[model samples]
Target: MKKKKNLKKIILILVASVSIFALIIFFCSFVMIYQDVKDNCLEAQKEYGDDCVDSLIKIVQSQSQTYRLKNSAIWTLGQLADKKALPFLYELDKSLLPQKKCDLDKYLCKYEVQKAIKWFQKGNITSWMYGNRESWH
Candidate 1:
């Protein structure tokens, strides 16, 4: 009888351990998927030029998707560094600011957008000029 009780307890503990590990893996898979999307979008931006901006803006404006994915889209938009995207980003940040309190992801997205705006307005030499030639156009 003593051995049976011990076996039952061990089995319960093992089952619980497996369940927790599975949950962790499932959560991590989603995290990986979001990162993959961010990377692919960045690649597309470079390859597609202005063609990808509309699709990216749609992703940012999408309310049905997870905020993590949306945040990734927001960051990619900033990296695109297009002046056309600036207005949409500003509208998004403005909308989020009025909330009682936004999450850290939202704050980061807003910061990234503002940083891109500054770079657009401020980066004159394109960094690759090496001080030899400067074109402001």
Candidate 2:
């Protein structure tokens, strides 16, 4: 009887161990799936460009944990210049240097590059907010 009880306890422990390991595997798989979807969404926005208006809005509103990804999404939205992305762009612009590790000046200059591209695409020479040093505010 003693031996039988010990065997049952061992079996239960093994089952519990396997269950915990399986749960870990499942959790990792779920995270990978989530990342894949996120990457696909970003790529889709890049492919569709201005046509990705709704996608850009969705990305801006996404509860992503990564600041860089959120900022990149906002930058992509700004490139689209949908105006729907205005609030997010403004928020990202406001939070840009403080949250990111990169040099503030460099980051602002990068944003200017994108803005310049956007202005040129629209043929709006008067919309030169990028070169205005005071506009980083």
Candidate 3:
């Protein structure tokens, strides 16, 4: 009986450890993806000038693009905080039903669009990586 308890405890510890490790890996991957998206946005702005905002908007609007790409573009728009993109953001927000649960596969980043809209509405832009808040208002 004591041996069975020990084995159960070991199994519980192992499962908890694996869960924590998996969470850490998931968050690390997410951070890397956000960084890459930010870099891509910066590079595009440098190469394309003001048109970069339009380009990102196009990506968000494109039905052919993957939801991941669309979400990245939505995040970039929030970071850019360009007033010109506000209308497009609003349109996107209006198009989606209120999400009771996050379904990125089905809704195509509806929550991200809402977040971007909130940033625009607040007239503030915050860096996703550095947490630097900039008031564009």
TM-score to true structure, per model: 0.45, 0.36, 0.56
RMSD of 2: 16.5
- Candidate 3 lDDT, tens digit per residue, 1-137? 99999999999999999999999998887777656656756554554444667877777776786776677778788766778888998888888877777656555667888888887777642344533312111
Q: Where does candidate 1 stray beyond 4 Å?
A: 1-38, 42-50, 98-109, 124-137
Sort every candidate by TM-score, greatest first: 3, 1, 2
Runs in model 3 lying further than 4 Å from the true structure: 1-37, 42-50, 125-137
Runs with alpha carbons beyond 4 Å of true place in candidate 2: 50-137
Q: Rate the local accuracy (lDDT) of all candidates.
A: 0.59, 0.50, 0.71
Rank candidates by lDDT, best first. 3, 1, 2
- Estimate, for each residue in 2-28, the C-alpha lDDT of model 2 and write its tens digit: 999999999999999999999999878
Q: Highest lDDT: give the candidate number.
A: 3
Q: What C-alpha lDDT, on a 0 to 100 scale, does residue 60 get in candidate 1?
A: 62
Worst 10 residues of 3 by lDDT: 128-137
TM-score of 3: 0.56
